[model samples]
Target: MKFAALLRSAALVTAVALIPATTATMAQVDGRAGPEFAKLFAVFQRVKASYVEPVEDDVLIRGAIDGMLAALDPHSAYLDGGDLQRLETMIDGNYSGLGLSVVMEDGAVKVVSPFKGSPADKAGIKAGDFITHLDGTLIYGGSLDDAVAQMRGPSGTSIKLTIFRPGRDEPVEVDVTRGVIELEPVTHELGAGNIGVITVNEFSADVGADVFSAWQDIKKEAAGRVAGLVLDLRNNPGGSLDESVALADLFLTDGRIVSQRGRARGETMLYDAETVYRGDMAEGVPLVVLINAGSASASEIVAGALQDHRRALIMGERSFGKGSVQSLLPLGPDAALKLTTARYFTPSGKSVQEGGIKPDIAVPQISDPDFALRQKYQTRESDLRGHLINELGIKDEEMESDSIADPRFQLTSAQLEEQGVKDFQLHYAMETLRRTTKSTVALRPAKR
Candidate 1:
C-alpha cells in the first residue's frame, strides 16, 4: 500500500514516530556566538587550503552536519540522497538484503533485531550479535552507511557474515543469501481456547487499522466470543507515533493516550482515546501486551499507555526506552533532517527515556539457548551514546532487575523444545490468558 494512503498524510513518514514539520525560524544571532562561527570558518578555510588531497565542499559540509547531529542523539540524523531513498524503502518498499535493524556502538555494528522471517533471521543472526566482518574484510570502525550499502545487493546473492556473540569463545560465521524483504507489519492468528494473537512486527502506516481488522478477523475465525488477546510487540523497534496512539485507542474508550513535550510551543502535543477510533473495538476482552528489549519508541508508547490505564497486562522483558519523537523536517527537495524534537510521556506522566516501560510480569525467553547470554549484553536507549537522560533520574539498580533470574522461570531451551514450545514467552502469555479472568487481566473493560 502507498504510504500516503496508509497514513492519510502524504508528507509524514515513520521512523520512531514521524510527525508534521513546522517551519524553523532562525534565532537572532548572539554576539557571543560570533567567535564560534569565525572559528568554524577558520578551520574550514585551513582544510580547504592545506589538506593533502583535494576534498569537495559538499563532503566537508555534510560531514560537519553529521557531526552536529551525532552530538545531539543517536536518533537525530541528516538524511539526503541515498539515505533518504533508503529510509523511504525501509518504510514502504521491498529491498534485497539480510533484513536487520542495526546500530553502531563503539565502532561496532550491533544487531538491534533481524526482521522476522528475513534472511538475517533465517540465518540465525540475532539481536545483540556484533557483525565484526563481512566475508573476510573487517568492518569495525567503518561508517554505518557504508556497511549497510555493502549488505544490500541484488536478490538471490550470497554474503558471509562473521558474528561476535557475547559469551561465546569463538566468532561464528554464517552464509546467507540476500532476498527481497517484504515485511508484514501486522499479522494475526486465532489460537487455542478462542484466544487471539496479533503480532505487530512494526508500526508502519495503517498499522492501527490493520490491527483492528485483524481482531475482527480473529473474532470471525473463532466463531464465538473472543476469550483473550495478546498484542505481541516483541523485537518491534517501533515506528509511526500516530499509529501507536491509534493502536492504543483501539482498546481505550477515554482518557489520555500519550503526551509529547518539546522546547518549541508547536512541538508539544497531546493524544487521547476516542480520537482515532470511537469506542473500544476489543470491548470486554482480556488484553495482554508483549514487549521486550527490542520493543522501542512507538512500542513503549503503546505498552506504557495500556499499562498506565490498566487496559492490558504487560508481559515480558523491559522495552528499549526511546521516549523521544523524531520529526522529518525538509531541508530541500531530496534532503531532510530527522531531528529529535520532543520527549513523550505515558498517560501516568512518566517519561520512558533511559528507563523503558517495566512490564508487569518479566518473562524470560528461556526457549532460546542463548537467551541468558544475549540479555547480558543487550543494548537499550540508556546504553546509547548521547542518549537523553530520563527526567525522573532513574537509578542504575532499577535497570539491573531485568537480569535477576526469577525462581518461577527455570525452564531450559531443551525442555521447552521437547514440549514443542519454540517461543516460551508467547506460550507463557497465552497460557496466562487462558487461566485469568477478564477483570483480573484488565482493570477497566473497554467501553462498548
Candidate 2:
C-alpha cells in the first residue's frame, strides 16, 4: 500500500567516498557524540583500504543506508531505482507481477498478503507463508527487493515458489503464472434481501469515491432502499491514509475520524467527519465491517472510526495492528525514504500498534478448512521485528479472543461448503443483517 504523502525533510548526507565536509560543518557535530561519528568514518576508511575484495563505493554507501534504516523499523526503508518504481506502480494500481506484498522476516521473505484476485492469491498463497526459493533458486538470505523482482515478469509468464508455511512439516512448491494486477480498490454486490456488500481491496486513490459509487450502484440494483450494508475489508493490507479518512467520513456526519501524533509538527494532524463528505451516505442503515489479521493501517483507521462512533458492527478477527504511518520522503531524483513518522490513533485515542483493532464481535472464517492450522502462523504487526509497541499496553487475554470457541461457529468447512456458504464471515454478516432488518423500516443509526 502507498502509505502516506511525499514529504520533504532536511537530511544529513555523508559522503562515503570523500569526506567533503567543510571545517565549519564538521564542527557542528555535538561534542558528546563526536567519538561515535569518528568511529563510523574510521570503519568506512578501514573497509575501503583493507577489505579483501574491492567493494564499490555505491555498494558500501547503499549498504550503510540500508543498515541504518533497517535498525529503525520494518516499514522504514531506503527506496530507489526498482524500489521507487514498484512504489509508483502500486500507487498506479497496475503492474505485471505476482501481486503480493511481502516483507523480510529475519532474512526470509514472508507474504504480508496477496492482492485480492491476484495470481498469488489464486495460486493459494496465504499470509505468513515463507518464500524459500524462486524457480529453484534459494533466496532465504537474499535481498527482499531481489526476490520481489524475480516474482515479476510479463503477463503469462510463470514462476515456481517454494513455500514454508509455519504449521506444516514439509515445504510446499507451487507454480504460479504472472498477470497484470489491475487493482479494483472497491467492488460491490447486491445480495438477497437487498443487502449491499462492498469489498475494499485496498485504500488506493479515489477509494472513498469508488465506494460511494458502489453503494449507489447497489441501491440501483436493489430498485429501492437498500437494507443493511457490509463493508468487507478482510485481507486488505491498507493504502492511502487520505482515502481511509474519506471513507470513514462517508458514513459519519460529525466527530473526529482519526488523529496522528508524531514528533514533527506537520505530522500531528486531525481528520474529522464532514471534511471529505458532507453527511452519512447510508444514513439509518445497519452496517457491518469485516476485518481480519490482514486488515491494517488505513483499514484499521476506517474500522476504528466507525466502531468508535457506534456506526457499524465490527466483526471478524482483530486487525494487523499497524497504527504507525510511513511518509514517502524524497531524497533524490531516484531515491525516497519510506519512514515511519507517526503513530495514529482511533477517534477514542486508541493506538493499534502491537495490539490491533479488536473486533466488536470476533468471527472466524470457518469456511477455510485450513483456518484452524493457519491461525497459528498468521502474521500481525506484533509478530514483526522492530515493530512499535502500543503506548497503552495490551493484555495477553485481549489477543486470545479468537482461541475461545463459540457455539455459533461450530460448522466445519465441509459442512459450510455443502450448505453453499463459500465465505463464512461474509455469509455470517449478511445473515446478521437479514435477521435484523426484518423488524424495522430502516435500521436506526446508533447514537453518536
Candidate 3:
C-alpha cells in the first residue's frame, strides 16, 4: 500500500492526482528578472562572508530551496535525505511508529486522527488532542518531524505522550507501544446483518487492486449475501491520485470519477469509470462512504466522485479540503521538489480546495465522550496558513451549520456509551442501510 509521496506531507491527500511530469521549455531569461537574481546572489554572498560562523554552501543552498517552497504553500517542500526516506516509507506502506496523523497548529502538535487500530488509537489518542510533550520533554513549539522521530521506535518499545485536550484543564499522559505498522490499506469486516465494512486507510500503491480484493473476501465471508457496505474513509489522509480514481471506479460503472486541471496539458486530464477497471465491482450493494476533516485529498476524490454520481450516500463530517495536486520533480538522485501543480474537481466540477467535500449527511460522532471538545479545536485544510482559496469564494459561516437544534441528535455521550454505541456516525449509517432495501439501492437515485 505505497502512496505516491508527492507532498511536503499528508498521505492526508498528498501525491499528484495523476503522475504527469509536464516540463515547459523556458524561454530565454528575461532581462527584467536580472535584478532579482542579482539581489539573491548578493544576499548569499553576504551570508557566506558576514554570518557569525561560516556555513557550508550546500547547507545554505538547501535552506534557500526550502525557504522558496515554504513561501509557496504548506504542501510544497524540498525533500531529501531523511525527508525523502520518510516519503518513501509512507509510499511503500510500512513504518514503526505510534500511527497518528498529526499537524502543526501554531507550533503545537495537534492530532488529526489516530490510524484505525494503530497503537495511538488503542491508547485513546483522539483527533484534536494537542500533544504538548513526548516522553516527558516539552515539545510545544518544537519541530513536528523531531517529535515524530522520537515517537517512532523499534517494535515493542514504548513512548509516553502528554496530551492537552481542549475541554480539560490539565493534560493527560498515555503510553503507546510502537509496532511494525504494516499499512493494512484495505481491511474488511463483516458486521451483524451481513453488512460489509471496508476501511481504506491510505491510498498507497495498487489501492484499487487491494480494495477489489477486499470486496471479494468480504463477499465470501458474508456467504454471498452482502446486504450493504460501509466504505470507511474516516481519518484517512490521501495518497496516490490514480489509486483514488481506481477505488471510485470500483463502484462506478460509467461516468467521470475525477478530473485535474493545471497550466500544463498533461496535468489537465479526466479519469472515468472502466478506464482503470471494467464495470462496478459491487453493483447492487448499498454504500455509505464515511468521511471527516481527516479524510483528505485522495479520500475526498473518491467520496466526491461517488457522491456526485449518486453512487454512494456520503456520511460524516466535511472532508479535509486538500484538492490541490502535487508533482514530484527530481532535483537530483537524492532530492526532489514536492510542488503544487494542479487542482482537482468532482464530476460536477466542484473544487475541493478550501471547502472540502460536504457529506450528503453530516453525521456527528456523538458516541465519543470527547466529541464535543474535539469539535471545538478541530483543524481542517482551510485552517492552515496560506492555504489556497476556493474559487467559489465560500464564506466561513457558510461552511458550518447548527446541529444543536436537531432533536434527533440530542443524545448525550453517556447515553450512547451506555447503549454500547462506540461510533454514532457508523451506527447511523448502518441504520440507514438497514432501512434501505436492495431494490432501491440497485437503482442509483437521481443526483440531487
Best by lDDT: 1
Model 1 whole-model lDDT (C-alpha atoms): 0.84
Q: Rank the candidates by lDDT, best first.
A: 1, 3, 2
Candidate 2 has which clashing residue pairs, if any? none
Q: Give one digit per residue, the lDDT tens place, for model 1 in 1-448.
A: 2333322332231334444444553236789999998988898899999999998998889888988899999889987766765666655667889998887888999898898889999999998999999988999999888889899999999999999999898999999999998878899999999989999988777889999999989989996888899999998988777788899999888999999898875777899999999988988888899999999888998999899888999999988888888777665456667888789999889999989999989899999999878877888889888998898998878867844668878988998899999999999999998987856946564343
Q: Deviation in angstroms for 201 in model 1?
A: 1.2
Stretches > 4 Å off in candidate 3: 1-13, 17-22, 25-31, 438-448
- lDDT by residue for model 3 over 138-219, one digit each (tens)? 9998777787788888999998999999989998999899987877788888888888899998887778899999999988
Q: How many backbone clashes does candidate 2 have?
A: 0
Off by over 4 Å in 2: 1-31, 437-448
* Per-residue lDDT of model 2, residues 149-255, tens digit only: 89988999999999998888999999999999887788999999889999998776688899999998998899678879999998887777778888999999999
Clash count of each predicted structure: 1, 0, 9
RMSD of 1: 2.7
Q: Write out the backbone clash pairs for model 3.
A: 2-91, 2-204, 2-205, 3-204, 11-237, 11-238, 12-237, 12-238, 13-238
Instruction: Give the better candidate number (2 or 3) by lDDT.
Output: 3
TM accuracy, model 2: 0.90
